[model samples]
Target: MSSKSEERREHTCISCGINISGTSAAKFDCPECGTLIYRCSKCRKQSNLYECPDCGFTGP
Candidate 1:
């Protein structure tokens, strides 16, 4: 089971740096480094690119 803190932790969209806490954000692991990445719905729809912080891998 997840702890309360873990459940309440907010993630920022990598493309726009917005809080993705209550939005329909896309969540996936970075292809290069397996780091978790989040993208807001709008950014995802527009295909905004994001770079993985761990491996610096950019993707659409």
Candidate 2:
């Protein structure tokens, strides 16, 4: 089983492609595929576009 740290390492901001392990990132389910999506505070503030890696769904 993977530890919490390992799982955190796997999460990245979909908008910036940056590792969000230690940041106050936002996590949510993709509206199209229900897959988990992460966005860093910076990107979220800028209204950056994010595409769901699983379903190819894009959103602001």
What local distance difference test score does each model get? 0.92, 0.90
lDDT of 2 by residue, 1-60 (tens): 969776656678999999888789998999998998999999999999998889899999
Off by over 4 Å in 2: 1-8
- Candidate 1 lDDT over residue span 1-60, tens digit each: 989998689999999999999888888999988998989999999998998999999999
Q: List the residue pairs that clash in candidate 1.
A: none
Which candidate wins on TM-score?
A: 1
Model 2 lDDT on a 0 to 1 scale: 0.90
Q: Alpha-carbon error at 52 in model 1, in Å?
A: 0.3
Count backbone overlaps in model 2: 0
